[model samples]
Target: MELDFWQQRWHENQTGFHLSDVNPCLLKYWPLFGGEGLDENKPATVFVPLCGKSLDLIWLASQSYSVIGVECSEKAVDAFFSEQSLSVQKEKSENFNIYKSEQIKLFQGDFFQLSKHHLASVSAVYDRASLVALPEAMRRRYVKHLAAILPASVSILLVTLEYDQALMAGPPFSLSETEVEQLYGSDFEIELLCREDIIDEQARFKERGLRYMFERVFKISR
Candidate 1:
């Protein structure tokens, strides 16, 4: 998607895709990575890319890992801190403003513009709506940049939506399981953790005449 597309979305407040509550899937599956007994010895930072105003950042903070989030829209970044009732100090950079608190720091700029130095400490990534939010043309570049910056030890928890794209123009783009595997399989050990058909539970898409919706979870490690 063009930067203008997302900037306009933020300007018009057309962010219906942003979730108000922390994702349940994040809470449920996160522990499998490092919350309890699993890999607590891993690094202490988690990277959240294209992270809009999701409460998942707060959940990450509660888990005791510092979170670094990158977003293009300043409004969305501001909303995250305001909605959480946290006071943040802003540091200006050439490409972005770094809004920081005790546990979370957000960079306001193009994700691709971010340097490896800023991301050197991050150990993993949590991508909920980020990948699908991009248009098909941008997904490859997005994945490539992510792969280039993240350390070899990093892990990824990604969620994606699948559906018949012929029926709808989407920001919540449909990506089949095979497509996801093709995108990241070369670099990481790709594992499919779960796939669920949530067509009946998806009221928004159903209203738009979409007949099917699939939710997929993927784990990627280098």
Candidate 2:
């Protein structure tokens, strides 16, 4: 998908993929970081790519980690702060605008264009939607750029959906477990944290002839 595709999705209010509640997988896995053995400390800086006003941002902030979310839609960013009732300060940079509060900063711009400098302080990544939002052609580029920009030791908490593509087209694309390994195995260790058939939970997918849909969660580290 291109930039306009997502911008238009938000503009038209066609965001069925946007979850109203914080994801359960995130809540379960987040505490593993900054615990006794993990390298990450409390008050870590977590990066969220393609983060479209996800309630998870506020949840992460509530846990004391500073959050930096990169979103292409200004409306989504504005809605995040407004809906959360947080005060924000806006500033323009060379490539994107920064919407900042004490614990959260949202970058309103292209995710691919952001460089290492923009992500230098990122201690961890929480990718709930960014990877699956792209088509197969773009997924490789996204993973490569993500590995290059972040520190080598960074860990990632990722969630993906897998289903038969012939049954339906997707913005929530079908990402197989094998593909996930091939994409990040070269540089990061991959651990499958959760995998469960969620087709019954997804009414739209059931309507689209998807007999089975698996929601997979992974813990990735270098």
Candidate 3:
């Protein structure tokens, strides 16, 4: 999707996809991937790409890693800080207003404009809505840019949806296991940590006349 599309969505408050609470999967599984106790006093940072106003950022902060969120929408970035009741001091970067606080900083600009220097301090990635939010044409470019800028030690926790594509056009694109491996195989070791079939429980998806809903968590390491 184009950047304008997202900006318009946020302007219209059309963020039905934004979760009201922290993701359950993140809370339950974050510890397995070197959570708070594992990396104390080390000054490690985690990168959240295209981060919406999900409470996952707060959760990540609680886990002891400084959080860096890159977002294109100004409304989303503003809402994130405002809802948290935190004051953001904005500074002008080359192409963004860097909204910064103690443990969190948000870059309000194109994600592609971010350079290695901006992300060099980061050691891990937590992607809940980034990859799957893009269309097929954009996904490869996103991955390539991410791989180019991020260091090899950076690990990633990625969540994806899997379902029949013919039924609906999606911001939440469906990705199969094979596609996941193929996309990140070049430099990252991708592990499937969990997969859940939720065809029965999701009445909304079922009401759309969809047959399946699959949620998968992947761990990517270099």
Candidate 4:
């Protein structure tokens, strides 16, 4: 994703990609990571890439997980803390502006610049929209970089959309099942949790001239 594109989107308040509330799929399916049994005294950390002021961060923190999120937009970072009424402190790092509260720390910078040391404590990852948000060329680089940096034991909960690209241009791009396998298969064991035909439910996408759209959820383990 281009920095200028996202910066312009944030400046113009053109963030339809920003959900009004936590994603329903996350509410119903987060426990599939089997992280609930982890010791509460030493909470597991969940990394959310390309996170954009999502309410899911709040929900995950409430579940006793230390949450780490990376986002490029500073406005989105500010909006998250302000909207949630969480007082946050800002700190400087070599590559990112770190925002912190109780259990959530959002690194504001380019996602590709992140390294393994930055994610040393992560036990799991939740990709509610990251992978599907990128174009075809960037998606492969995104996955490869992720695989390179994450610990071998990390688990991921990924959500993706599948639709015909010919029907529309996308940042909410259509990612086929085969593409997902090709991207994550070699390094991780993938499990399909569920898939639902959602075109009828997505009035906005329907308006964009899409006739069919499917949402798929996968639990990926390394």
Candidate 1: tens digits of C-alpha lDDT, residues 1-222: 677788789989999888878887788778767846345665589999989888899989998899999988888998889989999999998988999999999999889988888989898889998899988888888888889888878889899999989888998999998888888988888878889988998798899999999999887787
Best by lDDT: 2
- Candidate 3 local lDDT, 129-213, one digit each (tens): 9998998889888998999999767788899999998896787888899988888998798889899988897787789888888
**In model 3, what are the clashing residue pairs, if there are any?**
none
lDDT of 4 by residue, 119-218 (tens): 9999789998799888998998999999998987888889999998998899799998999999999999998989999999889999999999999998
Please, what are the lDDT tens digits per residue for candidate 2 over residues 58-138?
Answer: 999998889999999999999999999999999999989899998999999999889999888888899999999999999
In what order do the candidates fall by lDDT, top score first?
A: 2, 4, 1, 3
lDDT of 1: 0.87
TM-score of 2: 0.96
Candidate 4 error regions (>4 Å): 35-43
Query: What's the CA RMSD for each of the models?
Result: 1.3, 1.3, 2.0, 2.1
- The residue-level lDDT of candidate 4 at 212 comes to 91
Count the clashes in each prediction: 0, 0, 0, 0
What lDDT does candidate 3 reach at residue 17?
Answer: 75
- What TM-score, computed on C-alpha atoms, does each candidate reach? 0.96, 0.96, 0.94, 0.95
Which one wins by lDDT: 1 or 3?
1
Candidate 1, residue 197: lDDT: 89
By TM-score, highest first, what's the ranking? 2, 1, 4, 3
